[model samples]
Target: MAHITIYTTLLCPYCHMATNLLRKKNAPFEEIDVTARADLREAMRAKAAGRNTVPQIFIGDEHVGGWDDLFALETTGRLDAKLTPRSD
Candidate 1:
């Protein structure tokens, strides 16, 4: 499986929703809490292309945006492909 990383805040509902979906799919992910860490938040912003949102997800170095984007991928049947490890 491709490595998953998600930057999130403590009280963000979207973050919870995103994580719930990942859990349902049995996808292991590294969750970075940027609630009280300015440095980490800055790093998240930099990696997310200036998106200061609570949840910024990355799947194997590919920026997957926020919860809506991730859910879209799931609904469209593309998320599994992204999560699967590439033979190459």
Candidate 2:
């Protein structure tokens, strides 16, 4: 499984929705609550290039943007391939 990291705040509906989608897909993920960590929020901003939005996602070291972006990837039929591990 690919490593997934989600930067989130407790009150964000998008964050909850994103995680729910991942859960429905049965994808393993780690959630970092930026709400409680000022440093982490700063780091997320840097990593996201000033996008401080909740549900900022990272897939195996790749920045995957927010919930809409994830859904867009899914709609385009690319999410599954990325979620699966490649033997080569």
Q: Using TM-score as the measure, which candidate wins?
A: 1
Best by lDDT: 1
Q: Candidate 1: which stretches are off by over 4 Å?
A: none
Q: TM-scores of all models?
A: 0.96, 0.93
The per-prediction CA RMSD against the true structure, in angstroms, equals: 0.8, 1.0
Instruction: Residues 1-88, candidate 2: write the lDDT tens digits.
Output: 7999999999999999899989989999999999988899999999987898888999987899999999899899998787876979
Off by over 4 Å in 2: none
Clashing residue pairs in all predictions, respectively, total 0, 0
Worst 10 residues of 2 by lDDT: 78-87
TM-score of 1: 0.96
Worst 10 residues of 1 by lDDT: 79-88
lDDT of each: 0.96, 0.91
- Please, what are the lDDT tens digits per residue for candidate 1 over residues 49-86? 99999799999989999999999999999999999967
